[model samples]
Target: MAARPLDVAFKALAHPDRRRLLDLTREETSVGELVNATGLTQPAVSQHLRTLREARLITARSDGTRRLYRVDTELLDEVRRYLDGFWTDRLGRLKAVAETIDDGTTP
Candidate 1:
């Protein structure tokens, strides 16, 4: 079975190629353009784009004979929330450690 949508989104972003593809989608692009930017085969770029679409990280539309992709703002917001929470959680733990150290607890 496949994972949840959030898991799938994160998995898609786990690949550097896919992350770059997502970033490039910020301005809408065709597979050929991404191929040029990443120095990958057109088919490879299309495959990565397919994975991103499946993960709902990007959306595509027909621009004449070419397909153009755009970033899915909602998904990006969710990703931002997840990353922000991770940093906030880490900071909380670090703060606790600092407080304990200030109390003269040595380790």
Candidate 2:
């Protein structure tokens, strides 16, 4: 079976360098700028950017002779939705326990 989009996004985000790239892309930037910010070689930065693009986590647009890249927040919203389930479940359980304790229902 093929990996789901969320799975692909998670895999792409597994690398610290890729995560750093995402952080740096809070504003649109060029590959060369990313390389300088990351202190990574051009090839390495390109490789990471390619993976991020494939995962739909980032987008590139041609500007004059340069390509500007930025985070694709809509796709990132999917990732956030997927991760939120775990936190939501845990928080719900904690809230229930807290309510039980407040009601003197814990034994």
Candidate 3:
């Protein structure tokens, strides 16, 4: 993902409450259900949902009088790929350090 998009995804996930909301909405949920489950006000849930949608982490569908939200798999894939880069680099550094230690570089 682009730098701006990465920033948006990170910011959206920076909140514990938003993360919980995403967990609860993993299988499609409505705003009312999320508010009830999280004990947050409707407006608060709506605001979080808006952020998630804006970050492309969640998708919404209108169902009669209510709108249901679901996680966006493709968006998550992009986020995962971005994070995986860090993992790959960290693991490589760790391996190098381990090899050096084994070579008597330091105790």
Candidate 4:
């Protein structure tokens, strides 16, 4: 069976290294630059980039010998929308409970 998009995204984001890589890619970066910035080995940085690519969280383009990577904001927005639904509902319920308490109402 294939994994869901959200599951894949969450898995990709589970690692701190991967998250850091994503943050660095916000401005279109190469593997060498990532290694220099994060103090990680080239192979390790590449591995994180590969996972982010698979998750569609980042995009890559070849600029001659160097491959540039950038964050995929649309995908991140989709993930955020999915997570926001839960928070919105939870906050709404919490507000209702608080209002009830203020009114001295018991359920």
Local distance difference test, each candidate: 0.88, 0.93, 0.89, 0.91
lDDT of 1 by residue, 1-107 (tens): 96889988888889998888878878988888889999989889989888988999899999899999988878778878999999999999999999988889665
**Cα shift from native, residue 53, model 3 (Å):** 0.5
- For candidate 3, write residues 1-107 as lDDT tens digits: 55687688889999998899889988989998998899999999999999989988889999999999998777778877979999999999999999988899555
Give TM per candidate. 0.70, 0.74, 0.72, 0.74
How do the residues 1-107 of candidate 2 rate in per-residue lDDT, one tens digit apiece?
89888889889999999999999998999999998999999999999999999999999999999999998888878767878998999999999999988889646
lDDT of 2: 0.93
Model 4 lowest lDDT segment of ten: 73-82
**Candidate 1 global TM-score:** 0.70
In order of listing, the candidates' clash counts read: 0, 0, 0, 0
lDDT of 1 at 85: 100
> What is the Cα-based lDDT of residue 49 in candidate 4?
90
Stronger candidate by lDDT (1 vs 3): 3
lDDT of 4 by residue, 38-68 (tens): 9999999988899998999999999999999
**Per-model root-mean-square deviation over C-alphas:** 5.2, 4.1, 5.0, 4.2
Off by over 4 Å in 4: 83-107
Looking at model 4, residue 92 earns an lDDT score of 99
Assess the local accuracy of residue 46 in candidate 4 as a C-alpha lDDT between 0 and 100: 89
The TM-score that candidate 2 achieves is 0.74
Q: Which residue pairs clash within candidate 3?
A: none
Ranking by lDDT: 2, 4, 3, 1
